[model samples]
Target: MMTKSDDEFLDDIFGTAKAQPTLVPDDLMARVMADAQSALVKPDGAPKQSLFAGVFDIIGGWPSVGGLAMAGVAGLWFGVSPPAALSTWTAELIGVPVSVDLFGDTTAYFAETQIDG
Candidate 1:
């Protein structure tokens, strides 16, 4: 069997044929444009949000609101009942004796110190 060159094999397979162009019908193009125009048109009298609602939307909705509420509550709790270390530090700074009980009432201790001093 004789071996054929690469160009000879390709030319034999393709035979210099040009592909035919495809055209979309005018009716189909018109329908597509009409659908696109309808989609692009805005509805009449769209509902407007209040300033607060717009701000909430900018901050990413309900999860962000819940997170902000939780942060506020945490801040309030920490402000009312500070950590043990902070209390100890404050007591030392004020020349007051530190209490032995970790969860003891700090107000009672301060009252006793004030009475004794």
Candidate 2:
């Protein structure tokens, strides 16, 4: 069992106390308010940046823009020229002369093999 004086002692030792007042001088408050008011009143006569300038800034800042451009050019060149070269190279590697007749003249060779009775 605890005594009343012990409880009172604990309260006096560990209880929450009221905080002291924080003081702000009048001159500092006036200066801060004046600065804020000046920032709020910007001059509309200032020159604005163009949309093109903004886009250029973004594209120029991107680290991978040059890499992307190079990849695009390489992709376009490969797209236009690779499949035909690959087919020709494959045919040559397999020991056959690869001939492509795009206007359908190669079908004449097939007509010569007629049906026999």
Best by lDDT: 1
RMSD over all Cα atoms, model 2: 10.2
- Candidate 2 at residue 100, lDDT? 77
TM-score of each: 0.42, 0.30
Model 1: lDDT equals 0.85
lDDT minimum window of 10 residues, candidate 2 = 13-22
Q: Which pairs of residues clash in candidate 2, taking residues 3 or more apart in a chain or in different chains?
A: none
Instruction: Give me the runs in candidate 1 sitting further than 4 Å from their true place.
Output: 1-34, 88-117
Tens digits of per-residue lDDT, candidate 2, 14-92, equal 6544344568999999999999987885579557879977786777746657778899999898778778777688778
- For residue 107, model 1's alpha carbon misses the true position, in angstroms, by 29
lDDT at position 37, candidate 2 = 82
Which residue pairs in candidate 1 collide?
none
